[model samples]
Target: AMDDREVLLTRQEVTVAEHGDWAEVELYEAYQNQTWERQEVVYYFSLPESAVITGLWLGDSAERSERFAYRVSPRGAAQAVYRHEVRRRVDPALLEQIGPRQYRLRIFPVEPQRRDWDQDTNRMVVEDGPSLHMWLTYRVLIKIEEGGDVWPLPQLAEKRNVYWDDTSDRLVNGEPMAADEETWLPPAVPATSFVEPGIHRVDFPGGESVIARPASDEDLPAWPEDLHLAVVLDRSRSMAGRQAEVRAALAQLRRIADSDTVVDVYLTASEYHGEEPTLVELSWLDLGSITYAGGQNAAGLLAQFEALHAGQEYAAIFVFTDGSGYELGDGGFDVSVPGAPVWMVHLGDDLPLGYDDATLEAIQASGGGVAGDVREALTRLAVALEGEAYDVVDGYVWDVLPTEAADARDALDGDFAPFAARWLILAEMQRHRGEINELETLDYLHDVAVEYGVVTPYSSMIVLVNERQEKLLDELEARGDRFEREYERVGETEGQNALTVTGVPEPEEWLLLALAAVALALLYLYPRLSARGTLFTKVSHH
Candidate 1:
């Protein structure tokens, strides 16, 4: 395949090892630079919604590589270190989440190809370009849908040189299962039953096991009989053909509504009906009339929605959009909704291309949660309004087995194990961000991310070249973690000033060094010239 902008995705191979309820997915990618200069290859990808990143490795050759699972640091510090190391022309790879199920992989200095001689032609020949290979592995809980158990792999936009290695021969270390061997599956747990709050374990292949526990059982507040709903619809250019889907999703609200339910519809790119909440019947709310045009202003539309209903309380607020052209306004949504929950209903089949995970997390933290589809949105809304618990799992989940698994290893030996813990922890990390007590929340998330060895917004996956680089990362984290403690004691400004990390010299420092060298040279030559006497010039002044 032809390269794109001198960056060629030479090869991509994915291996899926399914273990009943969950699967381990390993993706290998090779990139080559087609030009005569070093390059930074940036690739964007998306994975299953329930996947947890567990490992990342990068190297010039496949035989040896550096692992990113060695250390866990705050995202900002990790980014700063990555920039610093990249400037030094050292090996450092960064994998960060850009949106829900969306990730950005950055590998530096794809070295240029070496020139060679053509003996027969009596001309210079160009050899193949240098390549960088990366291996990424993550654990995903199998999604149970109407079709069957599904494990979604990373979907890359570039389809060239890609291979899916899920054949039976390669499913388990290139060994196929015997025909007489029976497959194991986890014990069936009814979706409606109330699971106890504690650590639960399940066994998997290779003596590995998974564990999970419920987080909470807090029921939704009772719905208001006189419901006043405000729907913020996105009218961006990307929503042109998706208007029908939005209308159909909104029409489902009528199913759970009482006769008193009143709705006010506001378009993100259009003028509102009026200052007063224009009560439209659920059946008569004509979403078809709202034209999809211009860019989406989610923050401005929400502000207007709240402004128009000043001194009034709403039952619930629904934001309908595919999250394209979505911008995060200044600070988090600090508005007081008077006990009303904000439901961010995603309205597309694809992963949101524009909005990052932060935007969705912030909205969910504002009292409501994110719904994957129209049916999920309607179901969650009904549950929230009616104060009835439906399908929900509350608790912390982990990829590894519980501490108690060691003592009961023999007893717990089985084929199917509850491997949903890793996904649970990943989901909790998303919600744990942007909490009221920011410091404590970050501390908790950082610990969990490190303990589980997963990449998250609070924590990032950073691959270093050697031991010295590891020391540098450790030092940087120490400085940042210290500053976090100081931040609570003194204030934001003083705390930032107190934080300092030593690494490769900055540009300003290098400039200062150059000036000092010139000054020293002048000082060294001045004495010699003065001693020679011929350099001195005498002048007569009036």
Candidate 2:
């Protein structure tokens, strides 16, 4: 035992009295004054600015949400930041399995913020360091789940520390479960307080991340009770009854019901007769109830969806087929829906041949999102009708790829289609900088390679980019104008902060190099040619 008794910092429990759990959890820390030396601190935690805790549990574990239910903030707080709002309630069995636990917390700051300390003395006093650093703080999230989706179980909540962790504990006023050294403990009293509902946001210490949580009763952002949909299909007959594409699209729609989103499906048949048409909502058409009898009627298909889902909102209808207009005068894929947007998915290889560009534009102008391939199209429908995007890297995956990080990457691999669009702005910046000149280009390429995690860097692309920049520079130099240091930033703020230029090197030097090589080839030609021609003539004479 130590000569002096360490002072108890704070103690509290999260569950209710119904559990008969007695956790007189106490914490004793060395000390955390900014004035203290390095040894004074011991642990550190980091967290993103925001997160939507779909699930959580106490302490570390191997389960997804249950494992390591802690989230650390990247920003360091030298002093303890109190959050009085956190509340908890749990069953007695949970606390018993966990056992009586006490905390000895500490904050470890990185370099440029190390505290100096005397080797032998356990002094709580401060010392000077080479440099001072910022402080950060991490908090705990004690999870409470009823083992299922049913939330806010009134009976489970026995009591709570209406004001917990922020300040020292007051008397255990409600009821007592045990007698610890200093105070009587309550059989974790239950409380009625729950997390304030509806888009409650939490600010991180540094402010880099933001997450949003939604309640079940409220309407989602960008989505309404009445969802709208339009379908554009390819009708080139090659796709006629090509059950593969339809099955995939319908399967995607089926997943929507799980999230409680409404959807409307439309069938675009370019070859169907008398429908010389334009885009329009399927609901307004003279369509009848769908039987889903493994046939292709708009009404039958929709009814199938309705049968599968509860009373979900039937938002938009999409049609994807492949057939040309039946007659010469038939309008084919040309459809019009001024009010709701039509999602025209062209099936198979050929989108409707000679599909009117004006009609396609009109359909898009009606405010519909498009889908190209099965993967992209399905994801698009989910976002459009579901009104939410999957939470990808909503938390800090960090540089070190943990199992969770790998999981996030795997999900992102299918979700984030990188090839969809190239980084045009960064490409332009790399190009304009003449960053790819000779060995200098090697360094520039190396940087980009590292950024993109490319192991084997290509030298050829560097040379091409450098050559192009040099040629442009030469043209500008010849005009008695050179300003490589100043490419207009596409936007004001972007130009002001990120994009900077320095100088423009004339490409005339390269031009001269090219010309000199040609001249050298010409220079060695005359005598060698004369000799070769004479020798040829003599051989002929012989």
Candidate 3:
């Protein structure tokens, strides 16, 4: 503390702020007694080429005149690269392609010429005291291109040099900066943003932006009429807890359906018990008296849908279950009811083991339908009946344009225009399911990718099933090890008994060895002995 000849960096701090794909980084440094020192600070960072520099600020105040002139250069480059500079504080400073990998920002602070005595040398020397303060802030937008994987650039490391007056400059500490002293900034963590396969609107800080190109209006179809909805609810013992929720959802469906709409309600459980899943009139339908019992039979329920709607044409059929049902084989559900989309509503968390969400998705997709929760299934039915362009997020219903309806129809697999006209509504439902999260969702998607050869943006490198499989393998290995140890113990016990049989065999050992030898002899001779007559036959022949 007594030595005034040493320079010290008293304070250094860094702050990072993130907004969606964009991030703002600020670096602040304060040196002790270095106000008159002329120092050059260079920041080295790496960013994806897709990223664009949005803004830059130098000094403590935005209103303050630029006291430092900064230059940006690409990695391994000798000269500074000049690009577009925005004078307005609100605007961002743009830089052109400097290089492929890394970039550097060099900042030079203005300093006054001064001199001081070298106390150690007892001679005059130029003052190089640490008394300077500098703050640098910049914003970058990490643009994610279509079908491209990109992450935000991390914080940059600082390279600094202090000059002895204006004439002579020396590197700080006379050596390279210590790794610990040069703080490396961490990358900004991006928020989870979901984008459905089809075109949809995404809300950002400034305004709403549309992601993915939308289907053209000429591609949609007209809304269908004479549409009938059949709801097949799972009344199994497992669904006992969710009965109230099912009743409420049914009530909501009744409210949404028009008076002319024909809604048939069916409940399935063990042996097709309870109400027989009959086509009860909407008004006479009783949600209260419905009881839960038996094991779930999804096959029987589908058979009923096929029987009831044999001659009649239905707009859509919904089968809601706890996803626990008789194995419909590896191919899953292949039955398709003509002129109807069989929407599979997988209710509750107890999905069948070995069978995943992709199986249900494939089943529903094969039947020209979709699979989701109770709310989503009903919402799709409602939207189809309305036959209008409705935005699920805004809840705004637009007048059905001929071209728009045609575009919607083209989006779907069938000629049913209503199903297509409300494609956006369906798109919203597909993306906003509650079951999707970071961990499980990624794993589920990975399973889907492996099984069905389909990969989405949500797919992660980590396979979710691997952990469960590993646990199972560990359990099996432990059981095998225990069996092996038991087997060794039995062998050891037999060997000890053999050792006890010394010159004079113990009665028990002699008896056991005799029995074992007889057992072995019988096993060896059984096949050949069977060719000869039985003991009773031999006695009789003799």
Candidate 4:
């Protein structure tokens, strides 16, 4: 398996075009493979919370007309198409949302090229290699703060999976190379629609407009002077050195609340003696004496809290954790805070995939929220408590034809009706989460995603070479998650079994054999479980 460093990011160019309240951003990236064997590049990064990916293109040529832009389909179908194309040695690209505010891009079979270290020039230069050029465009509503509406840009943080420090002075095609540090966008004047104090509607080219209205005081619940708050601390191994930060946030929370507010602090991985209510002043000292150790016991902590409180309802419950590894006692995905609205605040830099799912489940079950940090969690909680809301656009009304936005730059002109429809569907899905059956909700979302050509949790974007591939994708989509596949054929060598077939289009003999070897190698290295709950055995070489 190739690591993150094998495929070199040779060049990057970004263009930001602003259109009123929202902005369209296009990112062009070129990656070079220095190895002799084919490679698949997987890039994992985050975008703005409100950003929506509208387009993606992959090709060897720089000309936009020569390349194919991917169309939206069910993620499962797109994945099937990508797999089918990969075996045939055809060009295909995929973009998927792996978690909240996180995305993954996959480009396969980057043709082998070469680069060597040049001691004379004191630079490792790219001798010759094929470059994979990619174009990604997304639209985001600008952030309106105290000063002005700021267009959000991609943050190429050093912690991202694809990044290189300054120590590696490298050159691509004899040109000086460095990683992208910042993005450039055109400046804009203040948005008057936001500053005005009345309900307003801004319409796009289509018969659609975003409507905003001020939040009235009647919309908020009455604030309670005597509020009971539960603070669940994740005393797991991952929180070893973050005690001071958590303590500081707790102190700030206490300061924001009334003096008579009751506080109960509990630690995971420790036996809950019972609901012993501690004041902020008392709990502040007790928190200093606590030690951090053991795996996260989120499930156990919630269970203990339930046992102690039983019928007692609090203002809200706050769980502090990095959403990392859990101990054996933790309930894993089955964990839930049933009685109260549980706000799970991530205490780390990047939220893990498992944790993100767990937080979403918790939120859906309890009706609270998940924040990237403690500060955000606190601010949102204050707004909910005070019956206050930010004066931003409430929602958009648009004639959404999910299937119509097939063009690459469909949303570039501020016609975000499809994107708006996608969000509306998602919001409805969230509202009906616990009410409707799981299968029904999933089916509804999947149908809408495919019909509207919008990328949801059930949908993704994939590039196909021909109509056959498109038909093949439809078949795969019909099969759904129950699509059982096994590779049964190998190369010309007898007594060798490499892959199992699911009755799709067959690849050429040479490509089939090449795929067989690759399949066998991959199976031997990583044992994959089939859809029927069976694992394939390693093939023996003669």
Candidate 5:
């Protein structure tokens, strides 16, 4: 079975994707306009430098000089610059080894001599490929390897995936390493060495040691587990124009951290003079481990982010960019930001791909399976990314909601725009995860409440409504006698998931606020649904 459909790009053979070209497009001469326009021929090929010499390379032309020779240069802060050329032409003699007799070409990395790792940072690391951009000199990021600087992790490890402490609750390289720590390990003594500042790599006596820059709250209390956060910033030259937006977003993120969020930031430019090819985290955000010049590395930066997210019950991530994700080694993103839940604050409407509606999903798939396009996707992707970044998941009910609530709220407004938009938000939260219920749902919903300035009751009608809703409390209290008698003292935390009534959703600070709104709404609706008192009636369902 001859696979004539198979084509080789840089060595690996791929079955051609089903796409319609002029060759596939059905067309017929319609009377008077028999003369064909030059634009009539639709070309699907990519060009060297976009803008002119348009369409496919039907053959060689002097204008197609780019096809013969091209070079890439670093734009900003060690950004990798990639150039594409025929690194090697297939030897006519090698055709016998290939199955197809017509022609078999061999292609390798555009910069086949490169020793640095390539990156496709727009997606997850373990699955994708690195960008084909030319190498740039980046700063040396030293992670303290086990037993005196052992093997460097090929890629940055995501949080909650890597570990070191005997107890998951204990620090790993000095941060919450595991999310299931509460149920897994019995608590242990706080390691003081983890709290001390400096670049000392000390063995943890019995437990494993991870890369970290020691920092802790000495004058203050410990950070709550849910407060941890990670901030990723795109530093490509295309983002240079939108730096203010990014900085503003960062400043706001910083202010939040000052109150309850533990924020750590990372910047991705080209690899510049660094020992490895990787995106760099320039600032640790830890006040204790300040260098004379004030710069940081991956471990230090993440440590600070963990500290910021340390104590608050809620956690969030605000990633402001035009959405031109990085090209990383192993061909994907080196992400380790872990928390109770992650909220990605993607900004603007600009996309990494040149076309409209380009998405993280699309950017992750853009690699043509050739090393060249993958490398170039890292830098040139910003070309389309230079404009604005917009959330592709439009319509609030669509399920996969935008990560950041505030950003989503900003893009939303109008008549039904207010309340209906909010409904869309709750609808969005519920879409991401199905476990959301009365209290958990309102926690996210209350962000809309605050954004809408409905935090406090406004009118007397709102007040009266709130008061009337108190009847539910009375009704629940009336059942106290029956509840205690029917439901005996439980064994352990087991049987906690029993399906029963008389159970109230324990509202958190945010939920109480939402419940207040619900009270107001119920009060107003009393004339309709209830005719008089509460949403619930006096009865022991159990």
Candidate 6:
């Protein structure tokens, strides 16, 4: 039963000071018994009526470093109203209570020098050795009603609990302190009036007023006339099975095109027989022209747009691609349009698109557009055409569709859940970039990809490429060391042979000697041959 005993409090004190619309209460207590194992101490404060607990400040003490946990809760509450395990500081907003009349504070202390049981005491003591002293001080701030008098200061309840002994006890009696023994109090400042919930003005006695209002929705810009719409279609081999969906989406878009809206269609692929991405009417779009082949050429499509929309002020471009063949060609697509926005419609499902998500996002972001599925792009387009404001939720702007627009977009047969899921993954990764290491980021990407059944190069291709690049650099370094060693060996050999003659023949000297011998032989043979020829001819004639 030694562990079933509670540490007796030797001394206790409570002090309260009244400020305008606020009261600061300070509690001081001392404990003689202590334990090496962590122990919990609980304190309760019964607050006045119409009191709003605003802030709490924990006083510094010798046991501050040993304090492992602190929690505050309403009277008789099952769960802690405010709990902090790693931080001692508590905020006012966290402790805001409108109707609670009582609050409890709990602290856990761990002293390394004390033992759990004492043999001489014949009962549970903090430690078996000399008396160990422990103390705690706490300050609580409460806000009261305006024009209300601060009387009946917060009273400290005698009931307390010890975790090691699992028993409740009362504070031991101590001599009452005189009023002069209280600590010095700071002067109270004037409290400002709390602003009303809605838009209003609070006028003070000094002719000054403060305006408070909720944020207003921004007005949508006017829909411009002469709006030129450009549609870029990807006719790559990867889009073979998805051509029907692409065509259906285009058909829906054609329906939205009005007289003021001039729609131009362009086809992009690696190889085109003739001048491709040529201008065609909406009626001319058919399955025959959707011959999927070659690679996707985003740059070529952008060039077509530049040529077609020259000098056009109000225009919008929609790019439809299955995200394949994006890596086949140069990604240097100049997507900068002064007054035009480019929306990317990512097609297909769960396939590894050639273009990385970052590249596509950058392209869309350059034009202040979004990259999503076909339906999302169409829905946003409809909202823009109708001159409706984008919905602002949770600090992010969203393009919400009207009922009619939603119905129209639903008619198109394509799913964008994969792209949406991928975007969520990317957003999370970007948000936690500074907090997580590279390995952690990769692990998160892998886990998310498996959960959503999506393909992401972050966990696969990108990591592989990085590893390959590292291996290549290592090989190049090894080769460089070998070359350096060979050069040094050759230099050392030449240095050793510096004084010795190489005995190598000089080509100039040998050539001059051969020339001299040939000249002598030719001079002697020419004279003898001329004399003999003349004598032989005269004897033959006789």
Candidate 1 per-residue C-alpha lDDT over 282-360 given as tens digits, one digit per residue, 9 for 90 to 100: 5666665666555544444465566655556666678777654433322233343224666666676544432333443
Assess candidate 5 and give its TM-score to the true structure: 0.23
Count clashing residue pairs per candidate.
9, 60, 19, 6, 50, 0
CA lDDT of each prediction against the hidden true structure: 0.52, 0.27, 0.39, 0.54, 0.24, 0.38
Worst 10-residue lDDT window for candidate 2 reads: 91-100
- The lDDT of model 6 is 0.38
Give the per-residue lDDT of model 2 (tens digit) for 1-542. 12111222233323322211111122111121222222212211111112111111222112233312212110011011100000000000011000001111222221112222222342222233221111111121212334421111101111111112234333333332243433323323333344232221222122211222332323223333333333433333445455576666656654553355444444332333324223333334333321121112222222233343334333444556432321122222223333333444545522322123223323333334234444444434444444222221111111111223222222222111111011111222233333322334434433432233211112101000124333432343333111112111111111111112323323654675676587567445533544332111111100
- Displacement of the residue 406 alpha carbon in candidate 1, Å: 19
> Which candidate gets the maximum lDDT versus the true structure?
4
TM-scores, in order shown? 0.64, 0.23, 0.33, 0.65, 0.23, 0.31
Lowest lDDT sum, 10 consecutive residues, model 5, at 92-101
> What range of 10 consecutive residues in model 4 has the weakest lDDT sum?
488-497
lDDT of 3 at 342: 62
User: Model 4: residues >4 Å from true position, as ranges?
Assistant: 1-3, 76-90, 114-129, 144-149, 156-228, 256-266, 270-285, 297-315, 323-332, 335-341, 348-361, 364-367, 382-419, 435-437, 446-454, 480-542
Error of 6 at 125 (Å): 55
What are the per-residue Cα lDDT tens digits for candidate 5 across 67-119? 22211101110010000011111100000000000011111121111111113
lDDT of 4 at 509: 47
Q: Report the Cα RMSD per candidate.
A: 14.1, 28.4, 29.8, 12.0, 33.3, 36.2
Ranking by TM-score: 4, 1, 3, 6, 2, 5
Candidate 1's clash total is 9
Model 4: lDDT of residue 456: 53
User: Where is model 3 more than 4 Å wrong at Cα?
Assistant: 1-226, 272-277, 326-334, 348-362, 366-372, 381-542
